[model samples]
Each structure stands twice: as C-alpha cells, then as structure tokens.
Target: MADDKKVLDDGELVLVKDYVEEIITDLKYSTEDNFTLKVIYNYSDAYLRYGTVKKLKKAQEIFKKKGYRIKIWDAYRTVEAQRFMWEIYPDDDFVADPNIGFSNHNRGTAVDVTLVDEAGNELKMPTGFDDFEAVMNYDPEDEKNKERTENASMLNEIMTSCGFRRSTTEWWHFNDTDKYPVVEGFNSII
Candidate 1:
C-alpha cells in the first residue's frame, strides 16, 4: 500500500498492457464499451483500471472451470478517477482516498469482476459492484436478496479459496493479498 504522500500524479505502470491484450485476444472476448476490456466501470460507469492484466487472467481461469468467464468492470483507475467516485459518494470507505495514497488498482493488486455466461451477460449476485450496502455481503440468508446473497457467497468463497479477498461492499471485487505491497500508484495501460 502507498503512503498518503506517495501517490503518483502522473501514474506509473502496473500491469504490462500486452498482458491484458494477449489475454483478451486469447479468450476470444471483447472489451466492454465503458471499461478497458469493454466492461462497465463502477457498476456501469466509465472505463478505467480497477484490476491488473494478470489478475484478469487468473480470474478467467477460475471462471472457466465453472463454465463461465470473468467480465471486468474497471481496472487501473487514476487519482482523478478516484476523485470522481468521491464526488458521487463522499462518505464511501470502499474507494481509497486519493490524498491518503494510491489505490489497489494503482498497485495492480485489486480487481472488480463478475461471473458471466458464454454470451458475457452478468450472473445474479448479492448486489452490483459499488452498491454501498450490506446487501452486497456474502450472506446466504439475507431475505431481501437471498438468491443474490448465496451466489455472492459462492463467488467470495471461490475467490478467497484461491487467495483473493472480497471487498466487503462489492461482491464482485477481489484482491491478492501477496500482491498488495508493491502495487501503490502503479499506472494502468489499457
């Protein structure tokens, strides 16, 4: 994690762009319109970095085993992008404060991903990414959203068992604990 004062203003390289490019091409998937790989950012928002190329590949492998694929929403966000999130939800604790330091994406340790069918449509989950509520927690019996909750729990379990941690608020978000240290302020090259 980057210190509050160590965030980069110009952004640094995180994942090698070729890594993302090669993976996308190899998978025969198309990038979403708003995100780098054409997935939606911030739950259908803009395109940016919230994941690294390598992470996406790993996610793809995991999803593939389950007969699905990973659909990335966002990856490698810039400081300005984080500022945009702050404007929309100032009280948000999920998004890192730009002033405090770089984000996980800046470090290339985090990812916002969803399970999708062969056609690339999203599956049911507790809530959409960045939903900002307990509704997204991996509870199996939250009546208000039971089906989604169970599914979210399943995803969380799978991801964590594979060394990824859920972001608490976003069912689709995950990160590799080991990769956290060197990722601060690392730039995205979508």
Candidate 2:
C-alpha cells in the first residue's frame, strides 16, 4: 500500500485505479465512454469502477478554469474486450497487437482521452481512436493528413507534458505509474 496509490473499486463501467499523486498530475487524464467499456467488458461479473474519477475531477477543474474540458474515447476495457478488438482489427497497428504479451488495460492502469472546448466539443485527433490504419496511429509527417496529425500531436503533447507517454500507434492512449500485478477476475465492485 503506497501512500499515493490506491486500488480502484468498480463503481462505474470504467476501471481506473488511483496512482501516485505526482503520477496523476503528470498524466493529464480523462475517461471516455469506451474507456468505461474497457473495465468491465470481460468480467461482467465484476462491478464497474473508474479509477481516475477523482484525478479527472481535479484536472477538469483546472482545465475548465481555462475554458477547456476533457473528452474520452475509451476506458477500462477488459482483456476479453481487447481481444475482440484484436479480432476486428487484426492488422490494425493503432491498438495493441494481440501477439504482444500484455496491455495497460489488462493491468487496470491506463485510459484513453482527449481535450475539448468549454462546450464539451472534442478537438479532432490524428485519427479516430479505433481506426485501423497506420495514419491513425502517430505519423507526424503525413502531409496529406495534416489535420489528424496536428490533432494527435497536440493531444500527445498535453498528455505527455502531464507525465503520460504516448503510444507510437494511438495518440489518445496513455498509462499511469500504478500498474496492476495481474488481470483479476471480474468481481462485483459495485
């Protein structure tokens, strides 16, 4: 039990565990609708929970004061749900490659989010989060896709500046310092 880290309880569709306070501050976080699905999709038996709710609230307060807000693309996706995504986009590099050993979602310490205006309007990203294309991942020099590239770059800068790292593939995805040891069986959190 680290003083700054805490296990997340499944109270909502998303499963986000709290991390070190500095880690939370550095992550520039948000939870989107899909992020919620990430948490409980595999373990339907487990209750829903969103780990970053508190951090998000705090971050939102600051962003809102600046006339900006957060938007989400996906949240707490279960390993099973990720598998489904792998099946649907087998060749898609934007998401985790199933052949890869693990994913942040499986560890319950990651989230997908973007920025929005005070009105809650999301700015565009390099590509739609789930879009199955190299261009959607993080190709910064694709002159043909300037809009998406710029969007992805901006989002990545914000998230990374806060201490989150960007996946070479998906710009909206990020991980927290607190990583789960193993994928727990879906249990009733709520």
Relative to the true structure, how large is the alpha-carbon lDDT of every model? 0.52, 0.51
Q: For model 1, how many clashes?
A: 18
lDDT of 1 by residue, 25-101 (tens): 11111233322233223222222222334345555677677777655555545556566555555654576766667
How do the predictions measure up, each by TM-score? Answer: 0.63, 0.60
Those runs of model 2 whose alpha carbons end farther than 4 Å from true positions after fitting are 1-62, 97-100, 134-150
Off by over 4 Å in 1: 1-56, 133-140, 180-190
* Backbone clash count for every predicted candidate, in the order shown: 18, 24
Candidate No. with top lDDT: 1
User: Lowest-scoring 10 consecutive residues by lDDT in candidate 2?
Assistant: 20-29
Query: What lDDT is reached at residue 143 by model 1?
Result: 82
